[model samples]
Target: MTEQYLGLPIGPADTAFGLMAEYDADQHLNKVSLIAGAYRDENGQPWVLPSVKEAKARLAQDQNHEYLGIAGSPALINVAQSLTFGSNMTKNLDKSIASIQTVSGTGANHMAAHFLARHLRPKRVYIPSPTWINHQTIWAGVGIHIEEYPYYSAETRGVDLEGMLSVFETTAEERDVVVLQACAHNPTGVDLTHEQWARVAEVMKRKKLYVLFDSAYQGFATGDVNGDAWSIRYFVEQLIFNGEPDHPGLCVAQSFSKNFGLYGERVGVLHLVVPRHLAAQGARSELLGLARAEYSNPPRYGASIVETVLGNEELKGQWLRDLDTMSSRIKSMRRELRRRLESKETPGDWSVLESQIGMFSYTALSQKQVTRLREEFHIYLLPSGRVSICGLNEKNVEYVASAFREVIGFNSN
Candidate 1:
């Protein structure tokens, strides 16, 4: 009886973090870590943006530690809103938008799941198959019925747009929740083209499905912040601004981690947009209630830093340069890795490396090859062969490419 009450099964460790621990323990000098989604400089070191450094300097003179409101810093939320939706849309949103500050991208996602699961109470939530690993776990934790729609195509090494839209047209119901990564899709860097996005939006609008846009990599994905946010803006214009009244609205979970290099700061905001005629005050209140009960308030310093940078014209310009620096480096590394791999006559198509945008690529390496790369070469990536392009630097790109060739060229199974 006591055993029954006290015993609970221990869950498996998180794959990325667990592997990170293993990599840390390995004593190999040339060991390379391609596991994390975080950015790394050409020297394979975590970088602090110049804009961030300046913001900290400004805050240091008058820095004060105090608990923020449950909704977080209004300044940060304002800038964040403008960042995600652009100025015109933010102005037009007016009363229909409900905004709140959360722990980070993860917290924003969890809050959205909790609020929607309780209030919207949809029949099922549709997530992309092989989405960010956390998507499934977040919705599942909220006790929502989860369904996976096709996302990527292994055959073409691109977004499986037809299959994804098919699922929406055939299976999804009105008011059902669908998760969409706004830009720089995690795991697989492939994103839907503008035409493909319009198609998906049309089907979603017709089906009256609720969209939860995960805007984790807005400015960070490409150098252009506005371009990165094209999908979300397009969706709002079609679904909310010009959409039906009865149609359930959408929400955005925005993170500043990758964009601002504030991963540890845990700064994020959640925006809930109701239908055209509906005011979001009630929904905003409910969100505040949930936020108050959970973590009380969001972090202060990080939000302050972000607000400082974005609010200032000079600092914001510097921040834009910072985005270019990170994105350009990732792009160059991708090209180099592809070039090296092809020059050695590695089997399979390596073009995907250059074609795919953002920090990650679906290398299409088998599970056996992944293991061999780790055990033999001490290079680490996810089991699904998703490698973080940020992990490849000037020093390690050749080594990583050579390892790939050795693993694929040998096939010692």
Candidate 2:
């Protein structure tokens, strides 16, 4: 056997496993856990939305074991369409939109990237500089070149909007694909204001660029579905109102993990808004073909639960209420963390934490400080100092704030 086959190379997982084993054996391991993803309840436990439980109950009584089509559950797909594009989206129901269920957000991204690589043939896909770590890996895995656009500015702890627009304006026409976070941006929790989104849409339209929206936290972001969907809805509206029937724009990847509290279930949708000129049946057939080769069909359990909740008025209302509860808790945690940090008179402006929305806060700590936070303080977070705000509660917010202050405070001296 060749050397490559004889000895497989170590990957990130091996490195992570080794590092975690050492930490597991160390004393004082309970200080903090450094997981960057995954939503936790106030008690630092995995959460299952109450609406999901009720939906599961309804599905269990007369559930069919029959295999879903390669494109996944039709009812689930319909519900997904309605949830993202709105119930009254004329273009959506008119067959101008093509949607397929996928394993989850990551899967949806992969599917879209593959399609773009094969069909769109853009020079490269431009992703945010500090986007979800998996984004680069996913695009590159499909043999597509990946480039970075300015996103988070560490100094200001906010978006580098001007820098971002500059890159987009100079991008060669029809040669770039820009991936946008549809709602709450991950890792930083910072989001674009309505005005900023409008500006971005206008620039992209003028440049004739393609857009791929990753909406991982739609309802979870603000507990208001329409509020979270404002950017995407505006994009679609722009295309329709402009009467550009053949506009070469608009694709969306939506995840049910965060909002539905269905993390491990791997449920998501990949949709494309095709030109009105294309035969509706033809567009749907093409999208389904893509799904046929990728995963054959998405799992039914999660999709069934989603459809059950969303298709029923009472269950949908219940789901919204549950989402509000989750959003409220995270909002309270942000305020409390800000209050605690301010009380300590932390050197830098910690006000950004309060201004930023969503489940995380980019704490702006250097990699060295982040290391100390983990090694000495047992406070777990990404090396970039992004903390899952959902992990904080009445019990741990003060402790986390104090640890943060101590690290930064000592560093300043």
Who wins the lDDT comparison?
Answer: 1
Q: With candidate 2 superimposed using the best TM-score fit, by how many Å does residue 321's alpha carbon deviate from the native?
A: 0.9
Q: Cα RMSD (Å) between model 1 and the true structure?
A: 1.5
**For this target, which candidate reaches the highest TM-score against the unseen true structure?**
1
Judge candidate 2 against the unseen true structure and give its global Cα lDDT, from 0 to 1.
0.81
| lDDT score for residue 124 of model 1 | 95
Model 1 off-target regions past 4 Å?
1-5
Total clashes in model 2, counting residue pairs 3 or more apart in sequence or in different chains: 1
Candidate 1 has which clashing residue pairs, if any? none
User: In candidate 1, what are the lDDT values of residues 97-208, reduced to their tens digit?
Assistant: 9999999999999999999999999999999978999999999999999999999999999999999998989889999999999998898999999999999999888889
Instruction: Tell me how candidate 1 scores on lDDT.
Output: 0.94
* lDDT for position 132 in model 2: 83
Each prediction's RMSD to truth: 1.5, 2.4
